[model samples]
Structures are given as structure tokens and as C-alpha cells.
Target: MDQQNGVQIEDLLKLKFVSDPQLSPDGKRLVYVVKEINEDKKYQSNLYMMDVATKKVARWTSGKSMDINPRWSPDGSELLFLSNRTEKMQVWTISASGGEPEIVTDMDHGVSNPSWHPEGHSILYQFTNKKDEENGPIIVDQLRYKADGKPSLTSQSYEQVAQITLDTKEIKVLLEGDADYVYSSYTNDGSGIVYVKFEEDEPESYIQSKVYVYEFDQKPKAISEIKGTLSHPVCSPDGRYIAYVGHDQKYSHATYNELFVYDRESDSTQCLTGKLDIQIGDVMISDLHSIDMSPSLTWSNNSEQLYFLASEFGNTELYAIDLFGNVDKMVEGDRHIYQYAMDDDAKDVYLAISTPAHPGDLVRHDINSLMEEPLTYHNEKLLCNITLSIPEPVQYPSQDGTVIHGWMLKPNDFKAGEKYPMILYIHGGPHMMYGNTFFHEFQCLTAKGYAVLYLNPRGSHGYGQTFVNGCRGDYGGGDYHDLMSGVDHAIESFNWIDSEELYVTGGSYGGFMTNWIVGNTNRFKAAVTQRSICNWQSFYGVSDIGYFFTKGEIGVHMEEDPEKLWYHSPIRFVKHIETPLLIIHGEKDYRCPIEQAEQLYIALKQQKKPTRLVRFPDADHNLSRNGDPAMRMARLEQISGWFDHYRLIPKTSRVANI
Candidate 1:
């Protein structure tokens, strides 16, 4: 492999993160956010506007702050976005022409989910007031309390939807107390907002939202009748229908989200993506971009059809659906459209796309002519000099003959006759699929002469609902076999891979699988488990979503069957592990918790097994995706160094440092 001329871990600085592309109401211009690390190696995001016809680009907003969630004004004269220039993130308004910004919300804590009225007379946003108290004894009484990034919020907090008039700057609380609301441009003719709310005090409530429209003139009316998890509800231009993405919990947490439309005229609701068998969101894992890209269901200008993105096979593509549920894939391509903005007539769509070879760039797709033009090649200069590896899609049969889909990335300087070390990379979400997208870590590893194999086993999205739910009660059974089969198929198809130097690594659920793989087999020379779970019984009581996720995936409660939980625990089979394992975890991670990694490290150390635990301080479950820039580079280097050290020596030999 060409180690010197390829992408390096520090290349993270050279990469520019382009996201949240928003088309002006007139469709003559587009505004987007470009995020990059500064002199201090800290992230700073700003807004930039581009002229559609002339391809002219100019900076719209600038600062050390992170400005995000850009939205166009109804009249297209101004832009509204969230910024963290102050002590906290708040809504800020800037003129269409680039200049300084004027603060909109003057809240002390912070605000989020900002939207404009149809007339642009006011702004709607969500604000939560902190209830500070004197130093006292901490009391616990809730089941659903902790979150991933911000560990525990033992104190009760409720987000309220509020509106502020631009002219007088007067604030009014519309929907308060336990209601989570998001506004649309003209929801209920600018007199109200569309929101999703779930009362924590409700019967057996565990975070499922109900959609409603809260009109200032009228009472809040329930738009969704089904008991399910819902998000991003938007109103049609004519205000005749409300569209949202959700699932009725038919398959618990493993259910595929379907696009549901609610007709205001007929008072009827229907699911549009139920038959598509594709997940209605971008699940492709990437370390380049922030990965929060969507209006999962973007309505067309005419309101006759809705454009949406879904994961299928090994890529995410765009599709349009009409009222009759006639879904048509707008076009076909191997690229991932993480963000897009359609024109007023829905004739031209601006896409922020990422491919196997490209980090991110902008492209304009003309719907009428069925032609696409590359709008911006922001990363071309940096990427051109680097030897980027492209992912080759491959499918293999599982133990039950079920075909598994994945991608194999060869080393940048791959040669047909030479043998290369192979690495199996697993994804975090048991429900997330590895797709046709650019993964920085994979490129870095491949540059070091390792072939990377990533696959979507059973319990992964992109596959059907049955396949996504296949590992509900069988974590180490079929999904385990599917991954092993993928590795076998990769080596079988490409015999040049040195199977004796194979390695495995993953985060979260992928980490659990890596641990399970070491215990179940001694094939891999080394394994790296990150932010993983070891004991299901302890995980059920420790993790943030443990109370439900444990039973939902394990198909049994701790009280119902403790033995079943232990049987699936990776620690139970630690005595059988032969491969040296490296455990990485975040100290403040509430999703999986550091205790999970601590348990594995302690057990392995007690047995004098070759293992090391690296803990990241002040980091949570999201450390890998959006962690501190310096820590992210260290994490990559640590994993690569461990694997390279183990593979460099011969069998039955150890590194002198170890």
C-alpha cells in the first residue's frame, strides 16, 4: 500500500463538512453550512450561499460559533438558523446578503428546532427553562432519565414550544409542559405549529410521540391516532395533509420506519412506505460528516408528490410518492444523498452527496430533464492527491442461505498477486447498515495495507423487517454466523488475503460482536471492542435504554429468565477466548456505559489474557462520530497501532513492547 501518498488521520483537518443545504423560496439560491476545525483544532460551522444560475458562492455568515439548521424565509429575504455564538445555542437571523446576524431568541439556557411563519412575521422554537435548586440530596424516581451525550438529567425537565414576534420581540408560550414541538413554514396558515408530544406521566409511557397541530385560534388537535414513535411532521402547502415518519412499534425497536400521511379533509391516515421494505432514513455510518441529514420526507412544491430518502441494498437513493402510494425511484445511482433541497417547481434538486471515493460535494439534479450537474467539488483538491479506496458491493449466503449484503474495500495500492492483511469492520447499530458511503477510518486502514470488509448481517436495516428483527432473541446465533460467512466469502473469493493475519473491530453492537467472535472462535489474530456490552443482566440495569432495549432485543426480562441473559453475555465465554483483545470505551458513556468495558478488561486481566482497556474522559457514546477532534485521531491511531503490532509478528511470537 502507498502509505505516504494516502489519507492520514490528521487529514481530518483538510476535510470540509458540507451539510444542511437549503434552497431559497424563489429557488434562485442555495445556502449551506460548511464545518471545519480551526487553528485551535476546534470545530466551527458557518453559512454560505450560492447562486443557482451563475454558480457564484459567497460566505453568508462567519464566526467562531457553530451555525446550523439553515432555513429560508417565506419571502426568501432572510435566513433563520441555530447558532452557538452566545453562552448557548439560540435562533439567529441573517439577511440573504452576507453580514452580521441579529439574535432572535433571548433565552438564558438555550433553544432548538426553530421555524418561521408563512408570512415571516414571527419565529417558532423550543425552549426549556432549567429549575435550579440549592445543594441537596439527590433523589431518583424515574425509569427514562438518562441520555447518551448528556448522561443523567435526574431533575425533571420539560421542553416547551414558544413563539416570538419579530416586530415587537414579544414571547408567547404556546405548548408547554412535556410537549416536544417542531414548526413548519405554513403549518395551519401560520397560526399554529405541528408538534410531536409524549407525556412521561402517561400509562406505560416510554418515549413515543403523538402528532398534533396547535393553532393559536383553535385548540391543539390530534393528527396521529396510532401509538408509535414519530418524528419530523410537516404540513402540506395547502394545509390539507400532515406527513410524518414513524412505526407503530409492531416490531418493537427493530421496526422499519414508514412514511405516514394524514389527510385533513378526510380525517384519514395511511402509511406510504409500508410496502417499500426500505428504511426511511440515512443509516450509512460515516466519520466525515455529522451524520444528521434529513427532512426524511420532503414535500414537493406542488404538494402532489413527496420526495424521500431510504436505504436499499448497499446505497441510499431518492424516491417520490404520490397520494395513491405510487412510489417511484426518481433515479438510480451508487451515491448517498445525505441532504437535498428541491426548487419551487420541484424541477431542480440540490443534493449534498457522498460516495466511496468522495468525502462530500454538492450536485444539482434536474427533475424535468433527468440530468445532473456537479455543483461544487469542495474536496477535490485534497482528495485528488490521495489514493482513495472504493467499496465493492458483494453478497454472500448466510448459514440459513439468506443472502447478506456488504462492501469490501481493497487497499489503495492493492496488487492482484500480493497477500494483504484483512480487517472485518462491524457497525454499531444492530439496525444500521453499512452502505455506499465514504468512511474515513476505512480509508486510513486500507492505506496501511489492510483490506476492510463491512457487511449488513441479519438485524440490520436495508433488509426487510423480518431480517431486521432476526436477532431480537438470537444475538450470537444467526447474526454471528452471517458475519463469519461474510468473512469466509471474502477470503474465498479473494484468496490473496492472509487469513492468518485477520483482525476484527467494531463499536457498540459491533463491539459486542467482536467480543463474541473472540470467545466463539480463535481465527482472528486480534480484536478491538469499543463501547461494547459484556453482561446483559448488568446492561439491563445500567444502560440508558437498558430497561426496554434489553428486553426488546433479548426477548426476555431479567426477572423472567436470568440464565438466558447470561447465556448471551460475552463475559460468560471469556475463558475460551485466545485472540488478544483491545477494549476502548468512553468514561461518560450512558448508552452502553464504561462498566461494560471494565467488566471485560477485569475478567481478561484476571485470567492473564492479553487485553488492554483505553478510556476516553468526558466522552460519551458519540465519541467516535462527533468527539473532540484530538481524541478522535488518537482513537484511530490506537486501534490501528494495536492491530499492526499483532500482525507484524509471526504466529506464537509477541511484540517486544507488549
Candidate 2:
């Protein structure tokens, strides 16, 4: 038998990530976004079309910038998308048969969430108003003034909903205020637009958004009366109901978004999946591509049923709910359905799916037959040459007897009786699940002769709401124990694991956990924390959503509970750290803010605790996943080399070296 080499960091650049599959009005053709790393070391996403029956694919757009948000016009004669071909991102239109795209909207700020009217003569887009620069000094009067990867509030603008007539190119602002509006879709009669609006005047507006119907030349009316955060407002084709994804703030930021339907005729709202317990909407975490916001709720043509993707037990599957509140699983498997598009008939579904074996591909799913047929193989050739590791699912009880779900990826070229160093990889969204999905980082580690262990702790989604919210008020307390216990379980279950050669790494929330683990224990020999939050006190002011996020996640206000914030912060316990640490941060990371990493690095350096800080230029919090290709590979190389340097070599290998 011949040995296949493991996947290398360079191989990651070659993998193609497909997303935003949109079935045409005729339901025979599909257009989607294929993102790949270009020669320039940056990601370039272009539109691609696929024939449903022939399984043939062709490139539809070519350019230096991204051509995404491919939404087909109602007549299917043209495709509407958001692109940055000009100086700024704007809405553009290209023929359905593939031609040069024409700029449609010339708004000062970039446009997003483009939707076409049912008549196909006009388009609705969302954009923020340009900031008033005439008034020299910028004012910071709002609690939620900044966002990660966006301009600060003082220089920022309010998101407004606008419509443009196709023939005349006349534009009209339908909704404008000190609020951010996300365009969903036009009403059945095309008399109004259904959107989620976040008004700055509301208390805790950052966490609260209402679904509203904005009529032309008329005031907007709220459709969602629930006291919770709401988004993804989708209208049924018949105009009888509005489907949305949200949950009451019973558990604050820990609440899962459940599917709900608003009866337009009855003027009442009903929770369809309140008892389902699973988190509704896409929860798949990937390092291969960036997923933009799209409509998650799709209604059947008859308006009798609604279909949505639900994150359950670690994988995303398609689920359907009827108007009567009967829930049925439409598609269930170990693969992640990141995005999907329903045909005009609503009988077939085109899905962008990723599994442990492949990065992503397009598939045609028959709702009635409950079968899926492969539609495109974008990475078939690249994957054939790569040796990928399959993860083995494991469940173990934490220190507090809470069951933790995790997976262990053995080295690609596993040898019996041979010990392999293990790496514990934590996910960013502490609320996100590490499920049965393709994780390039874990695969790369295994390819490099390292076992990778990842788990969904109490704070992670996929479990019931209670389990997901368990870690809200206790960031590093129970969640920390769950991770450590998972590591212990992995070591005990895998006899070939070299327990002493264990390493740890994570980003965002995971990064915070990595910092917390090092401060509380010295089990990990080396650690790499990326875009981590070290000081909650400073994070509340510096981060884009820090003010509200801190209160929701840590369950404390910076003004009222300064001591608690300091106590839960990893920097407070920095003196106890002994692991050789590597801090990786993005210069433009407004989420955690680069200062988070700086504070930890300086503290570790002051104590001479063997630390190094690597700051990526022009990169944000998503640097690991969607940053420059060169930087992504560089990060992986650094992480692998750091682990290799600190890993304990076996006696026989040590003797051979000597």
C-alpha cells in the first residue's frame, strides 16, 4: 500500500468554497458564488452557473473584486448582485445569459441585501447614509456606535432602505432614520417591503431588532411584537404570512433563534418551533470561506409550509414546518448545508453543502423524494491529491457532570502503537457548535502528524436552549472545565496520543478560552490565541459590540460590575500562566480590537513567560478564515511550527536525533 501525503497549508489556497446558490425563476438553472484564492494572495469570488440536469458548470463573471449576493430578477432575465468593481460596493445587474455587469446603485456607502420587485421593473437595496463631515468634530452619543470590520459610529452612517426603478434609474429612499435596516423581500402585492429595522432610540437596540413592513409613501408598521431580537424576515408568496428567525431574550445572548410565522390576515404571530430546541438558521463554522447574510426562511409556493436550515447535534439539516406548526425533518445528515435556494415551484432545493471529506459543493435536493443529487464538484480534483482525516465523534461528561460533545481527528497516516502529539482547537463563537462539518485547520493539524480534539461546550449551540445558555453568566467557569475535561477524555480514549505533548489554540471566544485555560492550568505545553479578548474592562469600550456583548456574555455592566469583569478576564490571572504563548491578532480586528492581544503580549513579556505576538496587517477578526491567502498560510505555518517546537519527542526519535 502506498502512503498518501497529508494536506498541507498551501493546499488550503487551492480549495474552492461555493456559496449563495440561487435557482432561476424557471428552476432549471442555478447561479452561485465560487470563492477561490487568487494569485494576488487574496480571495476572489465570482458568479458561476450550473445546469441542473447536465451537471455542467460555467463561469459567469470575472474580475479582480468580489461579485457576490447573486439574486435572480423575478423574470429571470437578469441577475442582481453586490460588487465592488467601482470605488465602493454597490448593487449591479448582469444578464442571465452571462454578460458584462452594469452598475445599478451609486449610493455613497456600499449596498447590501438587494431584492427585486415581483414586477421585475425595480430593485430595493440597503445602504448606510454618508456621515456628515461638514460638522468637524465627531460625536459619540450612542451605546452601539461601532461594529467590527466597519467604521466607528462618529464616522458611520445609518443604514437606509431605498428602491431604484430599472428603466429610468430613478431612486427613492423609502425608509431613512437613525436606524439600520436590512432589506428582506417585497410583499406579495409589492405594495411594501418586509425588513428588520434596528432603531438607535430603542433600549439595547444592539440586541433588539423588529420585523417591519415599510410601504411606499407610508409609515412603517411593526409585524413582530415579541420582545426579542429578530432578523431574516421572509414573506410568503401569497402575502398571508411573514416568516422570521428569532427567540425571546429569556437567556439574553444565549437564546437560540427559533422559526416563527406572523399571520398577516389574523395579525398574530406564532412560534412554530418553540419546542424543537434546535437552533434555527445556519450555524456551520468554516475557515474555508466567508458566508454573507442571506434569507434563511423560504416559503412553499402555496404558503402552507416553510423550510429552513436547523443546526442540530453538530450538523445543519433542512427542516420544514407547516402553518399548523407541524415540524418535519426534510434533510438529515452529517454534512453542513451552509446555503440553499428553493426553486420557484418550491419542490426542489439547491444546496451549498460541505462535509468532512470536502470543502464545499452544490447539490440538488428533492423535497418530496428526500434525496440529494450532486450538482457540482468544484474541489474534486484538489481533494483527490490530499489526505484528509476523518473525525471520530465522542461524548464525555465534564467536571460538573455535564455531557460534552466533541470529535477527535487522528493523524492522517496513523500508525498503531505510535504516539502523536495532540492539539486542542476551540471554535470562535462560544455559542457556535463544532459539529460534523469540514474544518480545514483540524485537517491540516492531522496531516502534520498531530491529533486534533474539538468539542462543543455548554455555551455552544445545537444543544437545547438550557445547555446553550449554561455558560452565559459563567464564561471561564464551567466552560473552562468542559474544555479541559474534553482534553482529558481525548487522551484517555486515544492510547496513541502523547498527553504531555498537548497544545491549545483558538480564535475570538475560543481565543478567550485559550487564554483562560493557560491562566488556570499549565497542561498545554504551547498555546496560540488569535483575536482573543484578554481584558473585558477595556474590551467594553474598544470593541465594536463590546459594550453590549460584554453585558450579554459576561452578565455584567462595565459601570456596575467592574470587579466582576476584571475577575473573569484572562489578564487578571496572567501571573499564573506558564505555557509558551503565541498571540496572533489582526490590526483591523474591531471585534476584539487589536489591543486585546497587545495587553496579553505585554503582560507575558513583562514576566518573561516566553511569548510572541504576530499582528497581521490590514486583517480583521476573520483573518484566519477570510484574510489574505498569504497571511492565512503564514498563520497555519506559525501554528504548526510552534507546536512542533514544543512537542515532546519520543525516546527513540530523540536518540536518533542525537
When summed lDDT is taken over every stretch of 10 residues in candidate 2, the lowest stretch is 649-658
**Count of backbone clashes for each model?**
0, 0
Give residue 88's error in model 1 in angstroms: 0.6
Predictions in order: lDDT: 0.84, 0.84
Clashing pairs in 1: none
**lDDT against true structure, model 2:** 0.84
TM-score, candidate 2, is 0.95
The TM-score of predicted model 1 comes to: 0.96
Off by over 4 Å in 1: 1-4, 151-155, 179-188, 202-204, 293-295, 653-658
lDDT of each residue in 420-469, candidate 1, tens digit only: 99999999878877777888899899988899999999998888888899
